[model samples]
Target: MSRLAGRRSAVDIVIGVVTHVTHHELFHDAARTLSGVDLEWVSYDHEDEIRDKVAEFLSTTRLDGFLAGPVPYTASQELLPPGLPVGVIRSSALDLTLALYRAQERGWGRTPVSIDTFPAEAVEAVATALDLDQDQIDCLPYAPSQSVDEIVAFHRDAFARFGERSYVISVRAAVRGQLSGQIPIMSGMPVPATIRTELHELALRIESDRASAQRFAAGVFLISDAPDEERARIALMNHLHNTPEFAGAWIENRGRRGVVVFAHKALFERITRNWVAVPALAEAAAALGARISAGFGVGVSARNCVLLAEQAAARAELAVEPCAYLFEDSGVVIGPMGPVGAALRYSYRSHGDDVERLAKYVGLSATTVSRLAALDQELQGRTLSPGELAGHLGITDQSGRRLIRTLDAGGLVSVEGTAQHHPKGRPTRLYRLRIAQALEAQPWSSPAATSSS
Candidate 1:
């Protein structure tokens, strides 16, 4: 069944497509068959303009996803915000074949041709299939570090080497300007079919993420040390009932000293700013003089969710401070969620002594390393900026940057790219946490490792 089959309302997805001016019509033609998606075009006449255009597009639009070819993506990759779904349209074999056919129509035979950006294997495969001489085909695969000048040089040198018998086929739009009149050139842009498929796939991914965020979740709030349990419970209930954030939630008393609230996980995410903090806990303590500890659970069934929430609440009670904890069906526990800077999260699942080993290797505490592991699991392969990581871990931005440096130095994180949140200043560096992989690679002298060996 389709993931979007039972959705209540049509999802309005906005996708930003960054392309050269020449390919704008191509992208639009490809998106004509798609529904429920509005494509905001960010077209650039030159590669130099891509970065500014992308930054302008992002600042003005609320895009659900982004798509660009390799050249534009590489040029402006560091400008894209984290967590925005991105699709990089590469030149497919079909695109290459079509370009070759067009070249043939123009009286430029397939042989004695120079191709750029397509993989050498793809070039070889197409050559073999068409019975063309592979020896006459010069190929240069795309690399992130390869510049426009370098690409132009490869074609120019190929033209010089092959003389008038050779023509150039390039996926890069920039090459057309450099070698247009100097040599016979054919554009190898991705065809509309390739773009259409990529657009559909990206739309489905956006919808899937939206649906997952809206899944039902339960939260259990307990008056752990109230002098008058009934009054404290009533106060907690009243506070939650009156809070605008909980207006959509079903808030009711669960026990003598507890109240349960049920709502979509997205609501909680908004209230907690993506589980960075639970201001309600502190608000209850300060405003109502009721020390409330919160436990939020997400599971398959309502009953099981409540049970997990209760368990999480008990865990929160173990803390000396008023805080909240999250217990997911996946056995990931994130807790001590008071102020953003004081919270710590760790998985309930055992990693044997890997956490300890990683901690030692990185010169950080086991608890911190474990928390990172839990965070990495929760992120599910999404890259985050240091500021976002800091917010999640409840630490200062500087501390977050320092932590990233530590993790990077210890080989536990990789630089994914940069993200520009605002229109000004330098972009923030994005990093993907590799704590789980690092922990898995940690050499442990435990019985589990020994027995497995």
Candidate 2:
């Protein structure tokens, strides 16, 4: 039933099966076009690969949630536990089961869909909307397990079928003022444009006889060359505002002249021109003051770009922005900025702690812990109850039927969701912990070491 979703799967993206295709194609598709990321179409078999595919998705892709078959709920217990939001597509048809299996095969973890029950009629609704063969959508449930190598194979195959080659320059914009926490694309991935010329030109004029990487590091000129910071600041801003992603922006005072700039930490070493992305952004910014220039820096990884961009933007503001007559000598750096990076960094750090805690308990590699931590943290939130606490701890509630059972079983803490009290009926019950809790291990009480799950 996921006709278009699978069709566009060659370009892997952060999405789930429950999302309606029309909306998915309109918005997310634009994001992929502007950002150059794509989803892939993975053809999966229902009976042979159902379980294996689901597990593979859990291990490899960032899953939103797993879809359960009409088979008994008891059989589906350990498949994806209650720690994460999950849905069960109620379908006895083998083909429909297969679509769920295919959709399940991508990420390490994802935001679970609230539609836990996908009845046959509901599946039919999707089938009608997607113009898919209802019979084929019937047979898609069942599987065993997939190897780690297979997961890698999935990425490789998808890339081989739809990979690009170029010196990549990425300009990231937060969507709807929110961080989606989508996986950064694989390294060595090519972007749609190049930046060597702009960067090379800036390097030639910086006066310092040092290497280009060092000379252009600051995106600034000597006081002797530009005189005062204000003149330099204004001159730089005029030019940077022309580049892509700065659309509808204006220069604002920091301590000095130019505006701030940030890009992938990698861009400090290479300047990639995104001529393709300029027009739309320019229009968006046209109504605003429309002046921006960046001070650039080089970092070994994207994380470093956050701090570097802040430092560079601050310097750029003081250095003076260019106007009317100049090439693309934008004074701004290409990287993520400060203030803009607060939330992203915090989430990354918190997620890191989750990995460390889980790593000690499971004895998995640091990489696996890191990957799984992302899934765990993204799937959890404000809800806190006895079962949730236990599930969050990844411990089994083996004690008894009571809430304390979570503690005895292995649950470290508990969490709960909204529930209504039963006046004269049986006790009201909400979702329970399907995951086990943390076992006694190292502690996370200080800066040197921390623990969380």
Candidate 3:
């Protein structure tokens, strides 16, 4: 049992593991070593049953984290709920090494072996460590599009070429089943150590997320141009008091025109549906017949939280229509939170002429370029596929593809690689936006150029 299991105050973490029936016992034995975790197994015997099984698991269980092998993850990626912590278990080099040792024990030498699903680098490293010839090894790295037949064919060809000397090592159970009778094969199942490490990491992530969600948050609601200040304030308070979502919140009046609320950050997130929309602001406006602006702040101290809320409320007041804004201690500003298309988020810091220059150079509007800049900052150097970018920008996939081409032409983005979220389609190209770098590279106006202008 882990230290977490010994803690009486520790909340039970439920983990859902999706895998083939063949590996159910293997995963169950591994999960037993994790004392505080409740493992819910969703096992499928065939590829076609994976999606329904995953959906059923999600609907039936409350999962703090999810785990699956690469094949199952790829098959059911689209079915998972957004923002859920997911861990994809890959066959480690250690697992591959064990499989090779097993083959050796069966009187098949490590040389002249065909392996599938393990990376080529891993194969080379193991073969080099074992003093095996690289030329005698045939490796087929895992691809999301790779089929069982293709793997079987690759191994069969290697065995045919190498005659009696060659054997196969496969990470996929289907491939082993396909080639079971005709060829010598070894299964490269992930060992318990690898599974345990992934589970521990996933549990830590879930705990961290829970802690962050429970942080203190403040919301300030202000009514502008109200005919009766006290009545409007009272009305706002009443509406919030009647709201089912705000039932747990602490609500009070801030000033003649403002109402304040205090609650866990998670409550606010639920009310706003994870910052996508705030229907309460719209509802308040319609009910009170006044222009209402709301600001939410999350900070280290209560005083700082209220100050930040006031600052965000001031920003909301400048907008032409009623809206809401969220200001965080980390300096992220998300708002004008109306409908989906109207909301925009960015850092509070000034962008100056760099955004304008980039926009003009790229033949896009300044606002679009600014949003892209904010998105680049939010990503923190992680690459995104066009489909994922579309989700972020609230646009169609085709539009995202077109925008990627435009950015590629303008030197604002570079293709990193391809990511196959699903098994059937072509892999989506991933790109990292270089908006900040592009802005820095723009030439400054010289004195002579200024004088000429």
Error of 3 at 71 (Å): 1.1
Model 1 stretches with alpha carbons more than 4 Å out: 1-11, 78-81, 119-138, 160-164, 222-233, 254-258, 288-293, 307-338, 341-453
Sum up the clashes in candidate 3.
Answer: 0
Ranking of all predicted structures according to lDDT, beginning with the best and ending with the worst: 1, 3, 2
**Candidates' C-alpha lDDT:** 0.77, 0.30, 0.76
Per-residue lDDT tens digits for candidate 1, residues 1-453, read 011112323467888888788887798789889887777778788877877778877787777888887667666655666346667677767889999999999998887999998865457658866899887889987655677888899998898888897999998877888899999999998899988977887788689769867888999999966679998888889988989999999999999999999988889877876665888888777766767888999888888889989998888888888888888776656666884527454444543445644564444545567678878988999999989999988877866865675576456898887788889876766889998887677633333222200
Model 2: what TM-score?
0.26
Each prediction's total of clashing residue pairs, residues at least 3 apart in sequence or on different chains, is 2, 101, 0
lDDT minimum window of 10 residues, candidate 3: 444-453
Q: Report how far residue 79 has shifted in candidate 1, in Å.
A: 4.1
Tens digit of per-residue lDDT, candidate 3, span 103-132? 889999887899997766557657867888
If scored against the real structure, what TM-score would every candidate get? 0.66, 0.26, 0.70
The Cα RMSD of model 3 versus the native structure comes to 13.6
Task: Please list all clashing residue pairs in model 3, or write none if there are none.
Answer: none
